[model samples]
Target: MRLAELQGWIVNILRRGSVLAAGGLMGAALAAPQAAQANLHQRYRHVVRIHERLGGIASPAASGPLAPGIDWIVMDAATGRILSEHNAYNERFPASLTKLMTLDLAFHALSHGRLNANTPLPVSPAAASVQPVKLNLVAGQTVTVMQAMLGMTTLSANDAATALGQYLGGGSIRRVAAEMTARAHALGMERSEFRNPSGLPNPNQVTDAYDMAILARHLLLDYPQYRYLFSVPSFRFEGRTIPNIDGMLKRYNGAIGMKTGYTDLARFNLVTAAVRNGHMLIGVEMHAPSWIVAYNRMTQLLDAGFAAESGAPTTVIATATSPQPRAAMPPPPVRQPAAAPVLVASRSRTAPVHMIVARSVGHVTRDMIPGWTAQVGAYDSYILAKRQALTIRGERKVGIARVGSAVVHRHRIWRAQIAGLDHNDANLVCSAMRRAHQSCFIIPPSNESLAMR
Candidate 1:
């Protein structure tokens, strides 16, 4: 769906936020076939009956005046600084927000080469039996891992999430939940526990806003390559276009998708990440009264964070890089003649040299030179990227290897680059750096480089 249309849809929904039940927006925006919705509700009603028999809410429906437990947090994605928080550590039902951890595990599998986008995962009877707000997969059928991820992200497909969890956990959803909890603890999400990949209600399955922030940050920084799955507006499957449930992607500028979740017990939960002028912030709202309130709270948190960061000089300062082994250093710049451009010499055989060419600082602005850029690395933090760029330039100077940091706004990452090198010089530097066992890549001049400014 287009941005304007999505914004209009959310606006219409928000206008009725007052009367909308906690889970009403979810059902309204499901986009499932009418029969599927009916069947899913019937299944949920049956579950509710079983729950009541075991002593739980008698009805699946939750009227809007949300009960007390509300936890919220906003954190600076780069620095791990807490911008604002309230009741952040209080555990509550996670609902579908639990899928973030599920995705985290899937991302780890993909990164480690154990899984791929085309890998097919089987849908078992247990997975097919998951409740509403799912992809409606048939048991014994296979869905590619990528399709399942999109289904989870866009449709919040319970069946797809369960299938993915089972596949990653060696065909045991119970095992995957344990792995998810262990992974959560490893990531410093100490307050989280996972009982199911679909975030279906389990009395023991719980998480807090603070832990959700940690999980969201991992999704953004740790599994950056697959982050696109979150922002996808929609995906086509079985000849149907399922719009992403994350209205933030379409409604808010610079909003990178995270996740949205709701269940009567969990009320409304949202984790959102947004970037502005190279600054990224993640906000979590758990147990919100309604979807509108959750989104509004997140927007306020991020807007205030960006505003504060803008007014103050960025805390994302550049840190000096630790010296690499002399053997790993690209051979020092060829000795320049006394009259030739002053070459800053290495301070010592083992010490990394840093030459501040005062006269040559602006010799090659990104706009003035039309050539490829040599990138050493892209870092989650500006400080790290700047440090790498500075260190790499000190070690190797092919042409004017002017250190520069370019913000890849789309990913909210900083690229450590030595811009202004022509294609030949770029290739030479990359080759030399590679020979020295250092990372380097030639990035051709493009609009993306313009972001360096």
Candidate 2:
């Protein structure tokens, strides 16, 4: 063929190839969005089912007048199947029940020869300073690891926890906390995190009923030898006697002691295990309105579990099957924007207004600080700002600022910025604040802004 003929053919081929590639690209572009939408829809369904089966949303009993304020979860100890759950995954402070993980690590150390039950653990100044409900160990004093374990499990001793943490962690409390968190994750307590060895009131120290249940189950199943520690009625150590805080040990039949914890944020949490007719059940409740309420709720859970077992046919040894695996689903789609805020035209109708103040340093996260009021004001100097900031160190931040031509004084601000948080997350943060008795407001930054004079 002539050069001109060959060139014409090559151009034709190139044009056809371009057309095919463009068509393929268009097809992919069209298909991708639909696929994403479909995946999102599937995920929504999965979440709904999870909420329903897990009872993480609203409980059936919550509608009744006698509904307990505590969030309760009960599960078959053998199979790890949830038997009855109410707010099973509702997040709450773990309190001293945090020691369960601490004890778990101690046991691991024993197993690994890093430490033994009879190992002498020295109480440091840090350990002796941990707040009350303690064994009252003095700094530089020594106690066996086993004694500390008993003190922690039976008496919920903060001092003992500190000593044990120091001993097991080789003198660094931070390392112990890190190991505790890592172990919690290894045990699949996904909803839980630990910041301290003892369940002190750290805002970051938090766990949920589901996660507690998981930990309790592991303790009962994986570490049966340590089970007796939970049942001790009292511990007498260092010239002080402390009684176990778990009421179920005395009140409930077949009750096995696990752990009890309380804090303003956690509001009384308990993990109780019971064995009835060879069937073991574990119950967890967090944020109960009162200690008595927590006890009653666990009792009810145990009764229900026993009743279910009794109803099952004997000799057949029927096992509760694991719940069906739900399909893998994507998370809920991004919510559409809300309707524009209504502007009232009538004199009687007023626009809803919100006020915010800076939080202080050392103030528990908005979720943990209770009964906090914001300081409103405009400031002119960094010195004033710094002083105000120091005052609310743990509760809020103080800074110089002006809002809409108003000279605000000593305004408190949140140091942490939650940028682009979704509605659910925002609501969660708000709820946490309310639970902790702190005040919070959502503020939208202005497109145009100016520094305060």
Candidate 3:
């Protein structure tokens, strides 16, 4: 149905304000699969954006032009067709969206009889040591698989996720993360990788918005029995009822449950699913400048998704990079150049997530550009990254190094970098830093730096 065809909705559209106006283009894409409408070969595929003046003021989009690298995708649960998307394939830091895989792994364990709901996951020192935005499970405390999942989903508890990862990894967090990444690839998440179960700021951990959407679809299709885990209003843990971190469950009509996350580097990330008129749709938004903006915008997109499905019933197609073959459904249309850039008024009042932690370390290589860089910390300010570099050099009292800022997602953050060092020297620096009880990753000049927007 075209704009006039959606007669009843026109009234609602006028009443909804700029949100629906901005999000309307997506609704057109979502209008479901019509043999004549979805033209994959066209220069302009499903892109629809409106940039005209409103309320006698230039829209925020005129000034901002849609913050770079923000990715979003919506898919029909019944049909795998990706109804709408932008920057959907670009790799990004997933933040807490990583927990969906943790949930998948745990659910896999349950289904395979390798672990039962009653299985005990004792908190390791590592799990306890993870920073706050955690459940605060003390070291040696034991929690059941169910308890941990509740914490992982509702509280977005880092400790619980880490504890579960440690348990499932056979005492090796790295091993479990590798296994999760493998499973994700097998399930058709081609551009995704994982470093930690909890989505702490690790540059090695990366996934595109489309990959997350595939994961969401699998969660809905693969484990319908466990759908309650994602949408539950609240769950009890350690004698407290922890409300879900997903705000849409209460605020947005038909909002079910999904995941949410934020880090200065990952920025705010979200994956949401909702149902209306018996149709289900999932929304994935990454690298939003603010939580409020991300949530509101997603709700608007989901409304479009539901409206689209209502216009026509969806047909099954591959969602995201799924390897599954769809002989009947046609390939997705080529992206139409957007008529207007997507933009939002981000209220940056909330402090950015502090992802970097500077600590005691030991290493030295003075007055020489070594060739390779070993990064230990990340900051929102270039000055802070440089200051941390100076402090590290001052502590070592023998090495010359400098700090640089890199773009992680849309957020411009500082990296505590020591550039111009050889591989061996970088290794030795990292080895010494690790021994000094710090974390480090060697960065080569040719390395795919996460700083690039």
Candidate 4:
């Protein structure tokens, strides 16, 4: 079967609850030993073509059942105070989020005058042949340091990132990866290891939420001047406008840019930073089941972190009218044998590195299956209702807050509710809100009033 047919067949089988069969067929058809082995060196590519065809609109989840690993954390970017976390130190694949370290090295090189933004770097055959979500860089062509970085930030281009690695490594990608890992260690990412520059599906390459959060904080703090590159929504590459894959940049109100990563093994990973009311928050999530879940949960984490930090109800609310992000669907990864653990250690630097710990706000995890909603209050405007819901959600640190409308007496009114909670969760949240003298009521799974946006 063709790639498209293979994708469709996998989806159909998965929907029918035959994950094992799909995996079996996929292994037989696509995971041939030779090809799989070759891919280990080529790395993978982003599905940029499909992403463009969809006009940057995120389609519904298409990857099979959710990938198993789930790790996340949210923290104050400036103060290093972790608001919440779960399994923050567990090792998981970092995928293309590895480019953040690559970019870190790039920024460091630029700062020390070791590399110039306009410096010409030659692309190798190795860089040109990596998988999709790429710029299709030709081996003989040369891309400037800025162009390569832009390609990485916007398209998550494997070719661009590889070429960057080769340049920084003096024509060696492995050397650059070692340097990346070394820098990560200096920044206090002890549990992480970097085997490749582009987070292709290397079994040995790994990291955790805590390590990623620390890396993100360093990127923001260490390279304030180059931070604008992360926020570049799109860039002109070879006459094509390549958009950033991190949809939160357009979907969430205060979202700045960080990075997004995925692979069959790694699932969906994201590190997001945003500024609201002058406070910057950094969030990291790993191995989310799908792209939609990854973005939604990241937004929830950031919202809750902001709400907790503000020490008051949040006034800003993200409405449905905000730009809907178009999702990119990469072709499924070929299965590979699990990799053995590889330990990585970096030489210590003189610069002091402080580790940030979670501030004990109870385990803050996404209510991935919210079966009940607690209605806080409704207001004249949708924004007001959403604001109230967000405030309550942050204050309570539970459920996904959202706004839906109702037509009452022929006049449309908005409803503010926190969804993604079960029966006991709903009751507990409502009781807490009631204790605080706030209006609180529970809407059952079948409640007509719980029309979420």
Candidate 5:
């Protein structure tokens, strides 16, 4: 072969060898990622098993016939360990026990200046109409927020719950109930649902003992400022003195205030938080055959929890993140622009930009408007899209608007958006949005946008 032909042949062979080597490297890179992912899953599974084993202690059923009616849970308040559980997650009507949530919100309101101890909350007609065990608060009459809290907690007054709900939620008991459900979910009380601000006889108002225990833990951990409200033995209101219904408070040492509930369907429900030996323990018993039985069972659980730490070598579960002192609740929510709407040929072809709705300290109201202004863009889900609205309350603005099932299901996530803005404002708003940790992007309007209509 001539010298030029030989050189050409050598270059071709080198190129082929390089291609083979590159292919092998790419294959190894892809396989390496999968191997790493599998290793991570294995590690996670191992940790999960270790956690489960550490938590797994056989809870012997309570002694004797009384055990059948008793459903209980005992937890280490600080660590959230279930020291013992018996039927903890069984569904039961919450009865007056539902007031704990009401009190929690009331306490939050007082702390944040949404309402104050001395603030006069109006007694709406609905509030006055609540059947109970009531303070007999007359409609159009007003009671101080402190007085209302005392009435509700010490006396389990349904009327007081309604009054607070009306005052804080704009006279709509239903709206307050919805807010309660939302708050409950946020607090991780997944097994609980609320139908009214007051624990009226709604068939739907039910929760598990375990869930109530979680709520009790949050109240103790997050809102220690209002702890005194739970401990009141007697509340004198409207010239009438009503003693606390929780008999355990007077009988048990270190007994803190918690609520009690009873109903035909729910039977008896009690949530008790007590501190012994510098350890706080929360015990919940629900649907007990009798009130006294429930009370005794809860006490027993608390005693056991206190005893669990005694003389036994403590195995610290490092999983619990150190508890941070409760901070103020978030600001009120704000509404924002809807996710990107479909575009038409007649409309401008400007690209939509994500806009942040609002920013504030603490939890925001679910309904506040995001910003005074916004741009627009297509989003995958209402939730994802809402991150761009500059307001803390933008989460609630997300909702599904149907363009077509294919588009909706494929990108069910919400995207952030603002309406008409010049390029400079859009860029500025987007930058601010990014600082707030919102996900956003710009999208050019096109024929595809027309399909949204």
Candidate 6:
């Protein structure tokens, strides 16, 4: 036996000298010393149980279930403090609400300049095949990224969900779904596991009310610029005008558009948010028996939370419209004119590195000029590659004149480079760039030109 175990036995024997004849107790101590420690762990659990399960319900369960097995929560959107919850962490099917993560990834690309709203997204047979609650896209038909977002949001289009996943995953739906799960973990949605982008009936997919509230909060706060995407009442696409199905957006007084879902298994899932008097509350209801029950319960919770005179001072209500009934969709995205910001070179200490602005869509072409090149990073796809190059170019406007892509090891990759420079200039540029904490390497610029030729 280990020294510690032996000491425990001796202490037990000394404490109960007359009980030595009860050899069973001694044997139990020797064979199951861990049982004693387990009690201590139980005590420890009681102490630590005072804290929450990280991002979880913080308020009292003031009310009971609206219906059997219904999970719901009301959270202060700004502080993310749970004002009220009921079975909030019980795992349940999410229905079409899975598109939130897919849309989250799309917005990430948009804000990072990796995707433009107008970028044409092709619909593959797999993407087109997602049934019911779908956009009915045909194989090989295409829609812009914004159009897809509209379809997904206003109509809960499963096809749009699949298309966005494929577009973001670079033609791999499974990879995008995996990315969604990883992103959910990173966001601290501990009770969520998504199997598909459209939240279809998958035995493996599940999430709870607490996790949905977390996602709803992030969707509102993280990308406020894209908040406009969620609220449109109707969108005219092709020949049909698709109307948003979110009843909260239609009827709730202060409600903004969030999402809605329904399946025999998931059964009336809705995530709704509202703002009144500079206060916001997000409500999530999953697996309600009927849509009426879900919305009524949600309305009751939101009404109580909003009416609570708790005077919470940490929250700033989002000022965007509730995405309620609105007539025309927002205008199509137009390219903003490039700022003509001049780059004042810092002290040129022999070798100077400069980050250049990306050329505007209408800028002068540098494709004809080619020599050696130096770049910072390689991208997995040409679109992402070009986007990164454009980002740095637009932000700093330095040595980046041309961004190019090549298939390396059978995988398409993009390189951020200072093109059109001679060998000496390229080396100098790379050395200077390295000083700025950017890794750089020179590419055979002439070889790329020849290959393109």
After the best TM-score superposition of candidate 6, give how far the Cα of residue 309 lies from its true spot, in angstroms. Answer: 4.5
Estimate, for each residue in 73-137, the C-alpha lDDT of model 6 and write its tens digit: 77777655566666665567788889888889998899999999899999999987665455568
Collision count for each candidate, in order: 0, 25, 10, 13, 37, 9
**Which numbered prediction scores highest in lDDT against the true structure?**
4
Report lDDT (Cα) of residue 131, candidate 2: 66
Off by over 4 Å in 5: 1-68, 312-453
Off by over 4 Å in 3: 1-69, 312-453
Model 6 poorest 10 in a row by lDDT? 42-51
Query: Cα RMSD (Å) between model 5 and the true structure?
Result: 27.2
Write candidate 5's Cα lDDT for 1-453 as tens digits: 479866764564455445433443464445544344435422111111111222322223332111346667776676666666666644567888888888777877877778777898988888876765566678899989887787777667778888987776777877888888877766656547888877876655677776788788777776676776676655556444444556567557888859877654566678888877667878888877654566666776677677765645433312232222232232222122132222111111133322221121121112111112233334555544344343422332221111111245455434344422334554555566578775544322221132222
Q: Which stretch of 10 consecutive residues in model 1 shows the poorest summed lDDT?
A: 43-52
Q: Score residue 374 of candidate 1 by CA lDDT.
A: 77
What value does the lDDT take at residue 369 in candidate 6? 27
**Tens-place lDDT digits, model 4, residues 1-453:** 379866774564345345323443454443344243433322111111122233333323333223355778876666555667765645677989999999999999999999998999999999988765567688989999998998888667788999999999999978998998988766666557898889986655778786788788777766777776776655666654455556677568867768988775677789999888767888999988766678788888888888877786654332222322233332232122132112101112221111111111221111112246678887888777867776766676555566667688888887777765546768888898888898989877554224432
* Root-mean-square deviation of candidate 6: 25.2
TM-score: model 3 vs. ground truth: 0.57
> What's model 5's lDDT at 364?
17
lDDT of 1 by residue, 1-453 (tens): 479866764564344334233333443343243334334422111111111122321223332213375677777776555666665645577889999999999999999999998999999999988765666688999999988998888667788999999999999989999999998866766558898898986656878777788788767766666766776655567654444657567557888768988775577789898878767888888987665567666777778778766786333221121111112112222121122111112112222212222112222222112235677776787677656666666565433333444445566666667754545767877888899898888766453234243
TM per candidate: 0.55, 0.57, 0.57, 0.56, 0.55, 0.56
Error of 5 at 98 (Å): 0.8
- Assess candidate 2 and give its TM-score to the true structure: 0.57
Q: Deviation in angstroms for 25 in model 5? A: 44
Error of model 4, residue 123, in angstroms:
0.5
